[model samples]
Target: MTTGNFPRCNCASGALLQGVELAPGLPALQCPACDGSVLKLDDYRSWQPAPAAVTQPPHVPEIEDRPSARSCPACGRLMQRHRVGSSPDFRVDHCAPCQLVWLDRGEWPALAQAGLAGRLAEILTERWQRRLQNDEIRQQREAALRGKHGDACLDELARIRTWLAEQPHRDELIALLRTGW
Candidate 1:
């Protein structure tokens, strides 16, 4: 509840550690100085309480090996398998998970799209989402910045360069740069 340093237990180890919270009700926590996982007192207390063993719920795997044709996280329709870029071997699901595309078995094509403006948009959107910690001042500042910038304002220059280098059209994009477009 407080925004100050608090002692927590390391989930991995039973060590007591210090942690800080940006806001309440957030599951994520970061250590103050060590930058390690800070164990929560509630977790320790629960461990101490030792609740009666109950029937375990059915196990569900987080990720599937085969691609799902179901709706994407980004778009609400079925996600189709498509080669994102020049890499024909690299395949990803499109339009399932509502703008959230999944890269499976291929990392090259995934990295290639990082050169495109889409990566910048994703980064900006993520940054904006992170700033929404119920802190009015931070929220307002982020909102102001968001308003001042359009899609072009999102900067992924370094990432784009790295991705372009790994991509097939690296020379082509570089040539385009020489022509000033």
Candidate 2:
């Protein structure tokens, strides 16, 4: 439900977004109903520092990550969801053609908390996305290995591997173990 020239939010409610000054010169169209914000990439790039002063995440940040894709308010194009990080996993929606971004409530503070608020542009890059995917796969593999080997055995094996890497005759020790007397 939009009035005048303000763009509408893509949230479930589809509320009209209101203009808000994110920083001194950074303006964004924020949804009054959902608290989401629509921001232009140019405005974000030119803006310095941030609008909020958050050194740490709130005790419980109100993050609502949207998994499904949504349409861009500026150009009516599909938005691409980019994973930011783990621990407190969330995705940012970017519309390349429109050069606009749809940030859900609490995403900015979460990014600042994760030390990635200044690198939003970098986060959307192919290299960064691939690295994040690789990290997730590595974590899954580690979890599976830990489950299969159990804590005690895995810990011993890890300790042994660390110790072996420091030894000068590590290869010889491995060979002797393989063909023990």
Candidate 3:
């Protein structure tokens, strides 16, 4: 029963909405206009700010200059264009400071309510998240192996670590390790 600006279906045209906490820790917002739903905090925090208009580092780039249609719900700053993943056409206005995303009227519903865009976004985001997690795990394993063994074994351990990390089911690997594999 907290109040805050939340992401809405861009298709809803700026409708005020309410959020319902479904479970102990899971909460989501329901758009009154389009009935679109989105996870509250986790989804909100995952949003990265759009790069500034000036110079950018190698991994980040400045988004195209576009007139903002709406202010960010979280920060009240003007939203800027942000491209998701490798899709050039999949752009949303994002606040650089607060990491809030503002979808134009109808954009949210078109992406979330219809299910196609939302599914794609969820799949892509999950894949990316898994990849990141795997990378972190791999790095940790490499660091541990390097510390215990020598650099000579690092490459061999890296190959095995990569294979282990890519396994869809990690329980077997974890159990094997727990048993002194």
- Predicted candidate 3 versus true structure: per-residue lDDT over 1-181, tens digit per residue: 2445454444436766567532233344555765434343345444332322112222322333234454555555565554433334445555556544444334443443333333333433446546656776887887888889988788786678888899987778878877975
* Alpha-carbon deviation at 12 in model 3, angstroms: 8.0
Model 3 lDDT-worst window of ten: 49-58
Q: Write model 1 residue lDDT over 6-71, tens digit each, in one string.
A: 334222333444333312221224433333322233432233211111122133222222433433
Q: What are the runs in model 2 whose C-alpha is more than 4 Å off?
A: 1-6, 23-25, 50-54, 57-60, 87-89, 160-181
Q: Count the backbone clashes (under 3 Å) in each candidate.
A: 14, 0, 7
TM-score-sorted candidate list, best first: 2, 3, 1
Best by TM-score: 2
What would the TM-score be for candidate 1 when compared with the true structure? 0.21
Q: Worst 10-residue stretch by lDDT in candidate 1?
A: 48-57
lDDT of each: 0.38, 0.78, 0.49
Residue 131 of model 3 has an lDDT of 63
Of candidates 2 and 1, the better by TM-score = 2
Q: What is the TM-score of each candidate against the true structure?
A: 0.21, 0.77, 0.32
